[model samples]
Target: MQIEIKSLLKSCGVTSIMVTHDQEEALSMADRIVVLNKGRIEQIDTPDALYDAPASLFVNGFIGHANFLKGRTSPQPGTIALDAGCALALAGTAPPPAHRDVMVSIRPENLALVSDAQPRSIAVTIRVVMPLGAFSVIDCVTASGEAIKVSQSRAAWSGRPGDAAWLMIQDISKVHVFEATTASPSIARA
Candidate 1:
């Protein structure tokens, strides 16, 4: 139904306004999207733009499933100390001034299971595994009880509940850092 409607809209060569609460539908059907939160425009961008580089925390959360982890700016520039007992090196991004509370978001697809030999790997205990056809969603928890989700190919991952594993963020650039709302709502590059 959706494919046919989209085809008709395309064939007609006319602009059509589609309003929906479904994020996936909006992303698939429109060239540009405006995200509204509490009746205010939060962001306006292409789906890829909104997903890859969200303008705000609200838009980041609204567009997809993001693991919001607590972190603190390390003394070293471009480094973040996660409350989850690991540090993230965001070499490609701008860091906030040292010693500030921050919130970090990493999409599940950007995380991969890695060996303990990996220097930047994070330790987590697997909690649940949901196989969704070609992909598998694994739920894990850090030492601080921070829940993180990882999506991997079903055939590639063979872990079970209660297993301790290491996770490596596939792309540090995809990691987004935001100011802790306790003081103010702001954006950070990492």
Candidate 2:
């Protein structure tokens, strides 16, 4: 499809600007990504950075489903704890000055489902289970009543709806932290 577009543009002897909401298609075709938010350029960077290091909370969520939780920094190095009334673990080195009103994005693939007893694992109750060809989707709620969705291989899900499970977020390096936003409620990660 991208080749076809490029050829079409070349044939027209005109430079073309393609617009799309699908990040994957844009990333694969465009030389550089121009992210627009409500007619404004929120960011213009390579696809890798756009995905790996988003410019804002809106961009982070727009690029993909990200988990944003309220958190604060600890005096100790290399950790941040949730102010969401539960202990949660993240997969990266602590950011400078201990972030307040924190927002973190955790991609579904990086989430691990485990028994509820695991330390720093967010306790959840299974709400829905969907099986895709290569992955399974599990919708669960944290103990604090926050919803979370995780996509894992079919083998990982051994419990049924109403059963207790834990959604463990690891590999903090892959997660991106954004400045918290209160203009609207943040969507739970899926």
Tell me, by TM-score, which candidate is best: 1
Q: Each model's TM-score, in the order given?
A: 0.91, 0.80
| Candidate 1 residue runs with Cα over 4 Å from true position | 115-117, 182-190
Poorest stretch of ten by lDDT in candidate 1: 181-190
Candidate 2: the clashing residue pairs are: 91-171, 91-172, 92-172
lDDT of each: 0.85, 0.70
Off by over 4 Å in 2: 2-15, 83-96, 185-190
